[model samples]
Target chain A: MKSVEPIFNDGFAGQPPAKRALGYIEDQKKNGKHVVGIYCGYAPVELMIALDLTPAVLCAFSNATIETAEATLPANLCPLIKSSYGFIEKDACPFYWAAEAVIAETTCDGKKKMFELIASRKPLHVMDLPQLCDEPEALDNWTTMIKKLKGFLEKTFEVQADDEAIEQAIRENNQKNRLVMEMLDHSALENPVLGWAEMLDIVFYATPGRGKLINDTLEKGVKVLQARVQNGYVHGRKGAPRILITGCPTAGDAAKVFKIIEEAGGVIVALDSCTGMKPFSEMIAENTGDPLRAIAQRYLKIPCACMTPNTRRLFELDRMIAKYRPDAVIDIVLQACHGYHVESFKVGKHIGERHHLPFLKIVTDYSPGDIGQLTTRIEGLIESIER
Target chain B: MSRSAGIDIGSRTIKLIVIDNGEVVVRKKRPSTYNPMGLCDYLLEGVSYDTIVATGYGRHLFKNYRKGEVITELKAFAVGAAHIAPSCGTVLDIGGQDTKAITIDPKGGVERFEMNDKCAAGTGRFLEIMAAALGFRYEEFAQEARLASRAEPINNMCTVFAESEVISLVTQGVPRSEIALGIHKSIVSRAINILKRVSTGRTLMFAGGVALNSCVAGLLREELGVEVIIPDDPQLVGALGCALHGQRS
Candidate 1:
């Protein structure tokens, strides 16, 4: 199949970040620098950078490694968790393989247990995440957790995360985040200027904190999209139902859902999942003096389904809807991801009652068994959305 | 005079319903082929319908096959159930390969629907597998369920796991009729689980080929404790709805 280029923007205009990050990590490994594998959203990348350790989010969303993970893990666990462990078990993910140690947050119960299995093979740091982010005690708990992370790095890796370096790290992260936001903001348009799958490709494949190259790629993408808008290029279908997709992160080549939606004549305008807009959704307080508190505050605003009293996530959804003007919402809950599955009911109520958007809850697994059924449902949903 | 056709290309059978001048003129059923497009082509070979709407598993495989578009089985079933039983607020459709529990709005729209497509546990395929395991055809399996004095409790919902349980039962000298009843009971139990996702309704309509099995449809009544309505030619409900939709569109 011939690959289609993005109509509005060219993301990762040079090499894709996933390939680039892997290559960079390999180069860093040769230079005797420790590569720290960051698993969850709560894992502190800035802190690792401050401690002179190259931090990279673990690469595990591969189809080949799932059977390897399933052999050791339970059959009914979330695909994401299985993919993570599977990537490690089969030595498939070079990012995790190159890591001297891994820092996994207790985001959900499944991942918490999966981390225990991971600890058996690799040096692992457990970051106990607080569910309620707005509560004063929760903030303090998160702040204290960040401090412990710093201390752990200092003790385990024998590196100093000095105040000056920490502030500089925060500056670097916030800068990259700003560029990513600009790239995301360009998604708000009357006509979708990019393919739904291509947009997800740019968002997900752009490695976490790959610095200059990835940042530059997103910058060029934003500029290219701006130019397209200026040139009066209406790239999307004229009256297609603009959709906002939320719920569990769609990892790796598990993009059949997006493809089905697009094929059904719904143009996905914004994605609110982990791999989409949320990772760079909130901006860190750059000049808070204490970079730890700033990083803690930013991570607290992530709006993950794992968060208890996830009203903030609903609020974020409302904000995205208002900004993007989506005609409908498609909430995807992966099978066996209990947290997202339970949260989908609340999301449905919110979308229907408050937002008044046509809601489609797709409870699916990564398996190919349900693709036809899903396509049928999505086609029906698109018809409903169009109506 | 305008005529419309609805073809439901299900996993097991293809049901074609034709409505001419707002009256049901013809209805046909044939085994679905490996080539669904060819099956649709063969079914409508000499037929003339102004509008055509397809539904079910191979519905998408009908793109460009006809003038009118294809609708999902859920939407078609909702329209069909509402048409058959005007007071049908809920629909429980168990097909050959998939099962769905749908709640219908007063305006003949689907309010909410849940499907069990990931696994074949609660589907007609489950019954077929169990019957084959008991060395009986699907018809004999239905007969076995009817003759059984009581259903033996079968808890396993997984098709692979449940087949083993059935094998173990046969080896342990449990009666085949009881085992068949137990398998039917398991499907009802799974259907109930999907139905519970949508709010319970006062009037429930049971459709799809499995609705032909009186033993299983009877269980839905005892379990739901509601007015259960099973229309004649239960499997044509989806195709009827699609034809109705085709006519309107």
Candidate 2:
């Protein structure tokens, strides 16, 4: 399949940050720099940066390695877990081999168990993530876990992360978050300055890469999009149905749903997945005397489906719908992902009853076989909105 | 006055209906073989209409070939059912490869709809497979099931597994009629679960080729305890709706 070029104004374009990050990792590895592969948004990559170690996102987004992973894993498990394990076992992903170690969190049962199998292959650390963020002891519990991770990283890399170093890392990471949020805000315009593919490219590529290079790349992207908005260079049709996409983490091959929605003439305005707005929507408070506590507070508020009594996610969805004012909402759930699939009822009800917007939940996998069915459903949704 | 035409290129069959001055002037149906486009061409040959609308599984392929408007079967069924039975509160369509249940607003608009995902458990194709497994033709399958003394209670819904279950029961000395009745009951239960999700009123319009099965139709009425309206030619509803849309546009 032909890859989509990211939309830009005034001929501003470059290689996707995801690819550039891989090159950076290889270059840094040659310099004898310590690198840590991280999975899930809950892993504190900020701590890795504070220790002067490179943090690379190790989540798998393609279906190529899933067949290899499925030989040991069950075919009914979530595709994301399978793909991630597949890449590690098959040694297909360069970033996985480049990392000196991997950091995983207890975000979901599937990942927690999969991390056990991974420990035998590589040096790995697993953080026991608290699922109930609303409990009074949740913050303290999570802060301890964050401190433990910091201790592990310091010992593993043979580097001492002083308060000054962590403070500097927190400040720089907060700036990166702000730049990303600014780039995403461009889509909120009546005539969006970014297309769906462009937005996905910007978020997925920028979020995983580390240091001044990725930050500068993101800043340049925001500047280009801002310039486009100023010149009234919109990416999509002016009056197309604006859609807000919410559900599981969508990137790589799973991005087919987003492409289908855009092809059906719907402009995506907000993405509520981990690959999009979820991780960067909030920032770590730089002014805090204890940056670890601040980071703990922010990451716990991610509102992932694995959390019990996940009212915060619904509140965030309400806030996004009000801000973006999308004509409809589409929830993309990967097949066998019970958390997102079961939570879709609450999401649909909230959107329908409170916001009074049309809601569609598309349960799919990482295969191309269901492209035809997806197109029909998305087109039907657009038609309903038109009427 | 010039006429408007609608063609539904379904998985099993292709249906065409032409409307002139707000009246149905032509109606045709043909088996949709491997090449649905060729069969669609055959169905449209010599049928004159000023406007054309295509729907069903092959609607997109038809649009690429004919360059005309297309609508999803979900909307098509709601419009057609409302027009056929003005008081229709919902529509349940069990087509060749998929099934749909749609709730309609009083203004003939689709309020909400649901379609079976990537699975063909309670569709017309499911019934045909089970009928063949029992060594009965499609037309006689419903009659045989209706004449059974009691349903033997088939437990499987997956088409392949259900066929295996039927074979196992046949070898166990269970009567063919009882097994046929069991198959009908299983399919009806599946359709009922889909219908219950979308139906809010007592009146429902049943469409698709599966509606022609007397045992299925009788079971739906018996099970739901509501008014079930089956149009004269149930499979032609989508084509009729497309024709109506062509007339308006």
Candidate 3:
């Protein structure tokens, strides 16, 4: 294999400019800029932006802090929850330190319960997320929750989230989402301009800031992708099996699956998770006159597995499979995550029966111990696709 | 006239198979100790084949050293099982460190599969440790289990815990054959659970080193009520599958 050249250089060099990004948050905090840390995509970022506060995703993605987190929580809990608590307990994560408050939602049981323990350490606000998203009352309940969050933000930061500010934030966030979508659209091309690793690096680098900063960075990324496409700079295996990754949010150590797939000669073309296209694929409605309700509607339709009768996720999967035309779909279910893990059967059935595509569900955690096994499974999928 | 070779460098044992014109010309198996590559060299010493494919746990290492193409054990087992028994719909391979249950499609492609996680609970290693705990040689372990009328019912599936459990059972003066039957039942139950997930067809082709244990095979047949087809050389199935790929390519 030394003599054989690697088909793709999957070096995930995107570190999210940690020191600088964290320092920026701290400097902003010192200047009376409140930062609200959020864990799930269900939390509305536009609300934070409307309140003149920076909203940062505080979901920990690595296993480094998991051991520490397991001390306070059960070892069998979701690694994401443990990692987050571990960082909070150790005061390690710079994002957690920079945040003045945390705005979390009742998404998964592990996180909802873990947030209670974390509330003692920080001024944490939990929003009751209605699981029956398709029901008529869910929108009203979520809108009320949004209003509640707005009220909390107003009281905590002493800033009024007026209708004008909320609308403006919505518009700005919609524009940022558009830019992100534009950047991700490059992968849909006949000759994909972006490799999965490069796409992740660009997305991760562009994510950690205010709407304008994120939009500007994403705009540059789109331009770079456009330029690459124009120059005919095709990357990875041209005819490689296109893989669509769905399930739990992937970043940090969880991203090893993506790296392994690409390294094993499969080109990852679409990501259906929160950290990927889910956040950007949908836009908040502008000119609707009720900005908060619009935000509620958009975030509630996230198609997360936590929602019961999550048929919308399958609908979204159908749309993604049709759009991306992936040869295979790999669902990365985090260990101990009952939501995605149980829902994997539905996902596999939909992908296989409906789309006639191969689906592989990988139940894993934020550890490097399963790399060999993961490689075998992922490579087996790729081999099946190739044959 | 050209011959193709496949080497399955499994965790416990390495198997090599050479095929020419759809006939297996050579088949070999040896314990893969500290230096598997040296043992692989010994296996390939007198073999003559045009192209080679590697499979199993150490496939990538063998691929790197020998410049042979590599295929995952899932595909290898599916193809090998299909080749051996065309009507076989499912395959269960309990290797040294891992266990895999795969359902083969109508075209002999891998339809769906489930592999054991990073733990060695229901693998060959688990049975080996339990066999040692019962003070039975590897060959006599299955024979002793076959003689037992009923299993002692081991509650633990973890290899380490099960070993201790076996030791305690011995201290309590439980029959060694019954404990041995209990270990077989434990591993068989784990395999059955995995088999239920991906299995759609009634015909199961059991392959791997574990298939040699008639006690386990008989138990699987009784529990699953499916036609259990054990190949002539069960350990060489993965290597045979790899050789099949070499022939196609």
Candidate 4:
């Protein structure tokens, strides 16, 4: 395995995650090495990495291409699905074309059906995700899926992935998760020690489960944050209402909501989205003999909105609320994201009634037209929470 | 008398309210032009107050112009509407740029809120733009809406396209009043669709510049199936809420 390359801004500060991730994938493509794109958290990314393929989480959530995607995709589908397919259909995502194969999961009904469309055009693989992860039968089902995925990768690429490689990958992945967790911990400070965007950029951009170099950069940032917090310093507009964001996976440029929240006089202290803090919440058992089951275990345990009987998310929310002590909980779902949107009602009812914390639910899409409206609503939420 | 003031610099209008000794002593409104900072400075040229707050789309822009909390239009509406109606459980504020429906707690805090900024339809500016395109003054168009024999169905939800549809109807020699009524119904449908996204409480209070338009207000009340209260000056609700927040501070 080659040493992971350092992403030092690619010669410019904040040169977007897609450019960096896609650039790396493009480089891998040039070298004739395989690249794989994984959608949804249920896809076994570590297994792909173990197979000597560069895994890029496919998320090009720019609002620019939604119009083209809207032609075929349902208008009511979430922006994440529409924009992702739009990236491919519009020839906007360089990484999507660069990848040798794409992986999709039945995390939701939208992505499940959407994959049937994407599969006809690109090299596609589908993983049937079990709705209930905690049940033993579901774990068995996930284990079978992971074993099938390992076989699929081996046959598709005509490459061998021994247990040793996956074990090593598991250790590497666990270390990366630990590093990411340490970085997110800074949000727990009485006053957060880093900027909301600064933390979010790291969480949003870093290649999940394999960003060794990004982890190194984040480790340095965490050290700086610790020293800053020790000195009684935090980031964002001071005295803004502290907020916790928990809902749909806010990935890529879909992070516009967090920016709007900050602009509306709210400081995001913690993010509970799949792309934000969920990946790091649990780690794989490094010493497991069957690394596929270990990977499945860790991946299945993720409290994604797709999971049925998703009580683990509530427990996780309780932990986050106790740690972050946010003044209000902002639940943002991409328009038509039923999993998060439905869970938001349960979460909202729970937190608002049980915790007596203010809960603001925001439903939006990747349209620039909604910016003013979102600002108005979120600004009002901040004010109400403050009072 | 200790006084607090609120300036709501909206996309189309600027509203200011002065609260003295816990009473709304003065209220004012001015068109929001390109130079809102200039317009705001002009509005406060001779005004005197101890503390002041600002709320609206341009709230942050006024933060440096004056030292005050940049309250959101949602909370401002919650405060202002509740102060007027007291029992206002929900607020539907249709402004020039945005339309919002917010549910407020008994303590005068916004509980849950929803907004429609994606389209100009269902807002005051929607009516204003459609009125101008039809070559009638806003007051004339609004007045015509009241005399509609029956609201003709205006199906286009997009404001720009709806205007074209209205123009098409005019070419067919359709009465301006019927088209105007149809246009008003489209916005009402838009508002009801947006309000359905969040909790629409029993006590609905209307604010923002559009609240002055009896056509939209009366129709909205009928559509929502509630007695919608309109404060003395609907546009100044945000400023009043700002002043109300100022008193608390």
Candidate 5:
């Protein structure tokens, strides 16, 4: 389990390993190995790994300077798309130069056009996945899509993926999934070995094909953490409320919500967010006879804030609440996120009315300094819960 | 005498309103440009003001005011709607670029609000795009829509696709007004979807630039099955909200 260097280097030549890696990908292509790049979050990373092709996930560029995205996209487009457009205009993304084919799912209307626009720019193949809100239909559509994708890969790579290769890939991916899930479980232990923030850093770094190394490090850290907790070194004082946080990135102001809860004696028992649990959830179902259906089923169940019409979020919340037995539920909705903000309130009200549970709502942006007010609010919420 | 000013720098237009002792002394709207400070200065050329509050997409970019408070358009709309129609419980503002439905408490506080910030399906920008496609000015487009006897809504959600659908309707010898009405109805339907997501109940007050378009408003009211209230000058609602913020502070 060795950690690979970060994907992007200052310049192509500055990092010899990364440059050599890119060259290796090019050589692989010359040797008839297909190269595919998948967009971040909800991508079938394991399936792609099983395919034996180099799979790089697309993350929005860190530095963006362009302001006017209205010319290309509608003014009302989501910030993520706007920012990604800005990144493209600025030529900041390294993926623009490397990958032979790119794929994006139709998660939102903004992302739909993002795929179309990127495809229009160059002769890139785009996979239009149906919105997963339609339950069985969505699962069926996704399975059909994966089979079509596998066919495309076979044709593009000019390699025959026999049953053995597919099965072996699925086995390797399942093992990887088990390790990642185990790491997540160990990381969640009360007063566990690793610091949450440090673990998140590892998660971000590991996303670019370093999962095994991260799992190993986390496995060791978890052992130490478990011993400390058993020795009562991680105990909190008398009356802290147990809680669960659901959000993205878990950095900046959003992460501050968790800090406030912890300070108020609330231990975050479990989380159901892409930045938390969704990244390494249950593996692509191993036992299903049809691998594509298994992959689709596994993805449809992944926790996403953007779940629409047939979203199982309410069910997920109920399950998390029962498992964690938290005093209250706090839903952090980021500004300009129409999907999450709308869903958060509905879920909050449902949880309050049906389950007789208390719900707290926190609206936030990217600033971490706003935690002072947030802390006060959480403390008040904790007081109310205690009463 | 304490004089306050509220400037709303929207994506398409910049609006300024000077309020002195709860009276709106001046109200003006101008095209929003690269420099919002310049636009504000032009609008407030001879006007003297005390506290200034700005809200909208470009609110944070303007730095010419003495004391400025930047608030989201949602909060600003709530404050503005409550000031004019005290009985209004829900505020539905469709701006040039975005649409929002805000449910207000009886005491004029925002209980909950939902906004359409991801697409142009129900926005004034969508109308403008439709109008441009039909070879008519935005003002004429709504009037022509009024003349429509019946509307057959084009159901595609994507703006690019919807625009093409409108062109096909034109090609098939459908009357312009009917197509325009259909476009308006489509916009209303999209808006209603969002309103349904976060609505408390019927009592909705419609504001923002799109509220002035009678055809869109009419379709929206018909679709929601609720009487929609439009302010005297709906475009200035965000600026008016900023002015009201000044009054409260």
Candidate 6:
């Protein structure tokens, strides 16, 4: 068994786990195996599994500087690009420097520009998938993108991704994704099988190429959690208002907000975050024989708040609300996150008018120390919900 | 007396204010669209000024308008805040698309400024998103936010994740007022952080569309432990600054 090494920004909340993933990946590379770097929420882990390559999801560098990023990208571009440019500028990650190939998608304007800029700097094959809200055309576009990505992967990895190999990868990935979904479903049960923090860690681990291993760990963890739930070992005694959280990457202060809610007796039933559900919920199409098409389909359909000029996002929210039946909604939009803020208000109003549910909007930065005020707010919210 | 006009072409709206003898006699706001020239002409109908100064996101795009003197939004904001509140030293301007913390000298000269131009977390746009999510018009967001009794700190930096978190809270039946307060507090914290990054002085003034939200301003006061000075018309600070720039230039 090859070890995986997870290398990421130290500022990321779950640095220990990210390091573990990086260690595993490093071990695999030591065995002369090729490592693939997947940027953002687009890489199909299942396809990576099928290709027998180690998948390393690249996150933005925390210490990125404007001076470093300005060498390759325009100053007016999104910070995500500047961060990526900073990574190349600093030569921080070996995976970025030594990867066999890099993969990305046109998920949003920032990501689209990121793909273009990164490709210009390095040799990368990008998949321009249609906007997920477009439905029929989105599926067709996604399928084509997947086929092209598969060809690129085959050429880059020099692996014979024959029909058998592709099918096998799809099946494994489907099972892995199903297990993950099942785990999330289990955690959201009347008596949750997993703790909120543990569930978040599970999502993070499942993201990189270590989905298979993480699924195995979670399977065991779920068994233990199920027994505990059956035995009534849950911490909170009072019935809490079930809730869902939506926001961008919960890197810094954002994660603290979740802790505040759970402490205030609000059970997080679902999450719609750039770093959490959006990356994991992307499932490969079942019928698509081409792996790249499967990847593109997953990327387009994954619900993201960053999709500008995308109205169909409301329908996605409606579905999640129905599934979770949350008593209320909270929007944790950061100060400068324009896309999510726009969607947050729109969705908050939609849920209020249509579902007749209460809506809460909270804005935050990347720090956990601000949880004191947050706790009071969540406690008050729970009390109001009870009333 | 010489006549001059200052126009702010923002991502969401266009603001035009005409100044004569250091007084703003005419002010107009129009939705920003594809044609910058057309919008400028429509707003400036029947008005002729000697000099025009352009600022904001789309300021550089208007080439035909008066060979205008262009100034960054930061400088324009300081000029505007100084005119409205001469005693204010720290200016916090939360616009439609971005948020900035500008520290000014006693004379209203910009000492230093920190801006969040990359993301949409603490801007007017974030409030608009929350308003839309709650089924309220963009105009009513500040009022709704004012109704908040307590603010639950939302922990996500990305707007997308934060919206989901907000939806989850609504589904759980959190009170509208508390949620509103929480949103305001979050934005205040972000603005405060930006202020800390640049320079922390005294007499912080809140400007831009977000300045219209007293709850947000109140939260800023609470977080920064300073009194926030909100002018009579917070939205016009940028244009007022531009008009003032016309007089000074």
* Model 1 DockQ (Cα-based): 0.42
Comparison by lDDT, 3 against 5, better one: 3
Error of 2 at A62 (Å): 1.7
Checking candidate 2 for backbone clashes, the offending pairs are none
Clashes of each: 0, 0, 0, 0, 1, 83
| Cα lDDT computed for each candidate against the true fold | 0.80, 0.85, 0.85, 0.79, 0.66, 0.68
Model 5 ranges off by over 4 Å = A1-199, A205-275, A279-316, A319-387, B63-67
Which candidate order results from sorting by lDDT in descending order?
Answer: 2, 3, 1, 4, 6, 5
Docking class of 5: incorrect
**Predicted complex 1: CAPRI docking category:** acceptable
State the local distance difference test value for candidate 1.
0.80
TM-score of each: 0.88, 0.94, 0.92, 0.80, 0.56, 0.54
* Per-model root-mean-square deviation over C-alphas: 3.6, 2.6, 3.6, 5.3, 10.8, 21.0
Give the per-residue lDDT of model 5 (tens digit) for B173-210: 99888988888888888778778866736678989989
On a 0 to 100 scale, what is the lDDT of residue A62 in model 6?
43
In candidate 3, stretches whose alpha carbon ends up further than 4 angstroms from where it belongs are: A1-32, B20-23, B105-108, B164-176, B200-202
Model 2, span B1-249: residue lDDT tens: 669899988989899999999899999999889999999888889888899999988998999999789988877777778888988898988899888888887655777777776778879999999999999999999999999999999999999999999999999999999999999999899988877766735598989999999999999999998899999999999999898887777
lDDT of 4 at B117: 44
* Tens digits of lDDT, candidate 4, A1-387: 012222243543465545555665666668677888888767777788788787777755778878888999989888888888888898877778777788888888888888898897767889899987888898889899888888888888988889999998878777777777787788787777654555555665555425466567667756766676666665666677889999887755667788888776678888887667777778898877888888988888888888887998888899999998999898888888888888888998889777888887878787766776677767767766766
lDDT of 6 by residue, B1-249 (tens): 888788887766788989898777898987778887789889989988988887776665664554887666777788889888888998888888778777776656666555663456778878878777767776776677777666667776567877888888889998766676677777877888888865665888888878877678766777777777888877777777777877876
Model 3: clashing residue pairs? none
| Model 3: how far residue B110 lies from native, Å | 2.9
Using DockQ as the yardstick, the better of models 2 and 4 is 2
Model 3 residue A138 CA deviation in Å: 2.6
Per-residue lDDT of A1-387 in model 6, one digit per residue for the tens?
012111121233344345555666777788776778777665566666767777776655343354587677665554545555677677776557656678876655666766665676555878775654456777786667667777787787787576667667777676666666666665456655444555565565666544456557656655655666666654343367877777666542246677777756787777766555656554566756565556565666655665545665667668778776778777777644567767776877687788877566666654343443354345545644654
| Models sorted by TM-score, best on top | 2, 3, 1, 4, 5, 6
Clashes of 6: 83
Q: What local lDDT does model 1 show for residue B170? A: 94
In candidate 4, what are the lDDT values of residues B149-187, reduced to their tens digit? 987789887778888898999999888888899888888
